[model samples]
Structures are given as structure tokens and as C-alpha cells.
Target: MFCVSENLYLRDVKLSDSSIVAKWKNDPLIRELSIGLDTKITNENQESDIKKSIESKQPYYIISLKDSDRPIGYIRLNWMDNSERFGWLRFGLGEERGKGYSKEALSSFLQKVFSNDTHRIDAEVYAFNKISLNLLKSLGFIHEGTRRNAYYTKGSFFDVYTLGLLKGEFNYIKRDDK
Candidate 1:
């Protein structure tokens, strides 16, 4: 079950979500930056992926516009190594890029995640993906560093830059958000 606020919503992904998910995944602009865009999704593929998330209790949810109920994206916190005290945040908003929604969607998503007592949140982005980097940085995520040639994409290996936001940072932003 997803707990959504009045302005943003997160819902348990349904099988019915496949068509849109497929469309989003296949979009060239989105695929060039996504983590799983290279893979083709069949019915079994979707079920298996969702099952894996469920089994590990990954916090996966579809994000949607509040007023129109139009699904826009999905965000998740995963690979939570107990000793690390943080989880990786990954999201792809598909063709819905540049509408000023990522910030709001992300702010709400972080609000939900940090509410659970996590120490920090981190994201590793391909250095070339300026859009994603900007979104994270605008939300106060700091540039930790980059791993040269870390990701294989678009017929080339890409450097991945890591960014992070501390719990206190999130709190400070929220407190000042008003």
C-alpha cells in the first residue's frame, strides 16, 4: 500500500500499469538514462521484477499527479545495506520531463522515505544526465564524487556521479520549505 499526500500520490504498482510502464521504459529519451531500460519486459518479466521488489520489501511506488490522477513516474529506495544506514533513490519520469514536477514529486518522495528513520539518501547518475543531476542538486543533494566510466550506456561506458542528502539536510529544507 502507498501512502500519498494531497498533492502527490504513490500507489502499489498494478499489472494494469504495464502498458504505461512499457511505454515509459521504451521512450528513447527515458531509456538513455534509466537503470533498466535496456531490458525488454514481458508479462513474466514484470511479475518477476515486482516479486523481487516485494520479497526484499523494496519501497516501490508509482507517482501520479494529484488532480488528474495521471501516472507520471515511479520512485524507489533500494539496496539498503544495513550497515550503510542509507538507501539509493532512483526515479524516471519518462516523457514528463521539464514540467517542474520532479522537484515536487521528489520532495514528497523524500518526505515519505526519511519519515522511516533512514540516515541519508544517495543517487548515482550518469554524468551526462544533466536533468537528473539538476533535480537532485536543487533538492539540496550534494555532489559527493564521480566514478569514471562506471555505467555502460548508449554504446559507451559513462561516468557515474554520486550525490547525497543527509537526514539533517532534508529536515532543514523541510523546516524552511514553508
Candidate 2:
């Protein structure tokens, strides 16, 4: 899948992206915010994961700068239903963090998902991840519930906020250029 935004584009993940992806996944900041295990992952391991993701037909895309087509981040949707309509969303930026790239990338990707007949998308954010929470909310995802002390990391427990956006609830206006 390919999606073009004003400043960025989302493209299918290739096996060649493993090294860079591994680098980003291993970053200290990324590890701190991620819900996944903090253990470092090898490029080979990331390639294996990418292979599995492709075989499973998951919506995994690299977010790249439109000008240079250089990948700076990734966004993926893991289906939670048998029909493949409901999914859990995950995304992270590499060196592009705090640059207003996420909002544009996510907005374009969410538009693509909804247009493809996706029913709903859910995202889990740790209570301390205020930036992510606000980003999701800005994109029309509602705060469904919260799991108190659901995750333990960084020597502390954190609440997990569950946010969901139904197709009917998504407020996106397709640009003429898209």
C-alpha cells in the first residue's frame, strides 16, 4: 500500500529496510515508549519479523519523506478480528521525532484504512505517553477505557489507555491531490 501526504508518504515495507528498522527499534527513546520487550533486536530478527508480516498480509508501511523518499518511521496495523476489519495500530518515528511528522503520516494511513472498509482501529498508549494520546485524540479516536497499572516498565507501573476509532467516526477529508 502507498499513501502520499503533503510532506510524507507511506509505502510497503521491504526486506531491505530491516537494518534501519532495527536501528530505530533499538533506540533508547523508542524502547522506553514501546510496549514491547526492551531487549535489543538484531537486523536478522527484524527481517524475520518483516517476512512474517508480509506473509500474513499485515498493513505495514514505512513512512518516508516525500522529497527524498527516505524512510523515517513505520506504521503497522495488526488485525484483531477474523474478518480483518478491526485492527490494533502501532507506529514509531526514528530521528524524525518531535517534528510533526506523525500526525500527517497517521492521518494519511488512517484514511487509507477506513477507505478500505476497515471497521475500527484501536491503539494502546501508556499513561505517560501524553503525546501519543493527544495525537490519537486529534485524529478522532475516542478514549474507550483505561487499564489501571496494566504495564510495568522503567521501574514503574503505568496505566494503559485504550483508544478506538470507528469508520463512521473518523473525520478525514480527502485532499484532491491524494
Against the reference, the lDDT scores of all candidates come to 0.75, 0.88
Candidate 2 regions with alpha-carbon error over 4 angstroms:
173-178
lDDT for each residue of candidate 2 in 1-178, tens digit (9 for 90 to 100): 4888888999999999999999999988777777455678899999999999999998899999989988999999999987889999999999988877888899899888888869999999988888899888888899999999998886888899999999988767445322
lDDT string, candidate 1, 98-159, tens digits: 76666776787787676777888999888888988977887889999989988886588888
What clash count goes with each model? 0, 0
Best by TM-score: 2
Which predicted model would earn the best lDDT? 2
Q: TM-score each candidate.
A: 0.83, 0.92
Where does the lowest 10-residue lDDT sum fall in candidate 2? 169-178
Error of 2 at 137 (Å): 0.5
